[model samples]
Target: MLKGNAYGHGASVTAAFLASRGLPLLAVGDLTEALDIGQAPQTSILVLSPPLPEQLPLAVRHRLHITATSPELVQSLSSLAQGRNQKVTVHIKVDTGFGRLGAAPEELVPLVKEIKKCPYLKLGGIFTHFPAAGGDRIFTAQQLNLFLKLKEEVCALGDCDDVLWHAANSAAFLTLPSSHLDLVRIGTLLYGQSPVSVGAEWDFRTTWQFKTRIVQIRTLPKGHSVGYGRKYRTKKPARIGVIPVGYSHGLELEPLTTPLRQIKHALGQGLKGQHFVFHPMGPLPILGRVGMGLTTVDLSKTPDVYLGDSVTLSMRRVTASAHVPRIYYLAGKVKCILANHEVLSPTGRKISLLGLF
Candidate 1:
């Protein structure tokens, strides 16, 4: 899955690399994202979301597979494909348990029949989504059973024998192996994250890192106020380093929608005493509230730390701003840098997106 800008790791670069590794098909969230890749990958691209009526022409013209969530969308695609004298492959999405963006189980048969009536539309696959695959095994199993039963009914029509059936997301890919049907749509696992824990056999290492350099260093006297609202003050004379990263870059940002999560966040904040960033020498405590674009760190403990030294940060990858530069490395060497929507080599030469791999 190469949606959400490849989960904020930059889709163009990620798609090129994955294509080089011989991935036959890539999936994205929408038609716009499919166009964003711009022929960088030599593979079939599937749009996993239903396309708008206005977007169907572009989708069919580009030969991008689309997910059919309703009979109305299927009809729109059929008309566009017939007008263009082309065939469009569509995967029927059933809302087995995921309550969003798919035809209900009861509606799948009629939707399938509707697609079969359209000569320009071809049924490439049928898939469903899991809402709680990681935490709820029984629910996921029930969803799978429901999908399989519906699949049996769809196959009885004799036209969908060649249709691919997929339902496993990353969580289900790990927890419920039975859900892995003809194909599995894995996003988080490809990014080296697992919603469910596995044993030692599954050795998944983190594939992305967020880092920033110290741009400025300063010394502040006792009782000096720092950051907005003066939420923190120096207890004594201390050395601080400033990094050009904060909430805007997804640092220290998390969802606190539930009361339990909010309470857990509060308890975690109290237990940690102070937020810190990682360095080879040791941890550097944050000095004040994280700003929108700048954060202050206490560097008194790491006397040898200097300006331009890089420090690793804890950030939600998907929430990180796309404006931030992503430096890709291979075998301990800088491979390419993705910044401002361009891919460049370490020597500052512009690299063709098609030739990235």
Candidate 2:
């Protein structure tokens, strides 16, 4: 899934890399993301969400596949395609249990029949989603079974032999083999993350890292408070370093949904030792509350570390600030830098995504 800017790895770069690897079809969240990928004539791009009626022209012009969730949308798309004299491929989305955008089970057959009646519409695929595929085995299985049964019914209606049937996301792809139909829409696993455990054979490397240089270094006297809230204070004289990364850069941004998680997050804050940034010498502890654009790190442990030293931070990629420059490396060498919507070489030459890899 090349959606959510390929889950914040940059959709253009990710799409180019995956296309170079010969991935036949790429799926995006909407029409804009598909356009961001530029023109890849050899590879097909599918928009997971239904397009707005006015957006149909561009979608057809780009040959982008769209999701068909209702008879009304299918009819409008068919009319548009017929006017353009082009066949529009559509995937019927069945809402097995995701409770999101898709046709309900009882509505599946009628939707399929509606698509079949359209001369300009081609049924490309059928798919469903799993909301709890990671932990709820029974519920996931139930969803899978219902989707499969719906697929069988659709097949019985004829003209579904070439229809691609899929239901597996990254989580379901890892834990449930039965849910792997014709195609498995995997996103997290492709980015070196898994929702479930896998055997040693599947050795996935961490593919992303967020790092910044130490902009300043200073010392705080004993009992001096730190940060805006003064949430932390030093017992002894302490060395500190400032990095140009904070909550704005997705640092310390975590979702505490449940009460238990909220309590755990609160408890973890009191343990000052828990927050640290990585360096070759050792980990540098974060002193106190993270500011909007700056964070102070306790650097007494790494006295040799100086200004301009780079430190790696733990951050959620999806929430990371887009204003921050992204440096893409290949085989341990800097290849391209994506900054301010332009891709440039290390030597500051403009380049295309095709040349990035």
- TM-scores, in order shown? 0.94, 0.90
How many angstroms is residue 213 displaced in model 2 relative to the true structure, after the best TM-score fit? 0.7
Best by lDDT: 1
RMSD of each: 2.0, 2.5
Give the deviation of candidate 2 from the true structure as CA RMSD.
Answer: 2.5
TM-score of 1: 0.94
Q: List where candidate 2 sits over 4 angstroms from the true fold.
A: 257-267
In candidate 1, which residue pairs get closer than 3 Å at backbone N, Cα or C atoms, i.e. clash?
none
lDDT of 2: 0.87
User: Which candidate gets the maximum TM-score versus the true structure?
Assistant: 1
Query: Can you write out model 2's per-residue Cα lDDT over 1-357, one digit (the tens) per residue?
Result: 988778778777778778878889999999998987786535799999988888888988999999989998999999999999999999989999888989999999999999999999999999899998988999999999898888889889987888999889999998999999999999989889887877899989888889999999999899999999898899899999999998987888866756777777777675534688998999998888899999999998888999999999977777776667788777898878877767788988887886455
Q: Give the C-alpha miss distance for residue 153 in model 1, angstroms.
A: 1.1
Tens digits of per-residue lDDT, candidate 1, 1-357, equal: 989889988888888888888998889999998987778567888899998888888889899989998888988888898999998899988998888989989999999999999999899999999989988999999999999999999999987777999999999998898999999999999998887778888878778889999999999999998898898899999899999998988888855756777887788688875778988889999877999999999998899999999999877688788889888887879889888888899988888877667
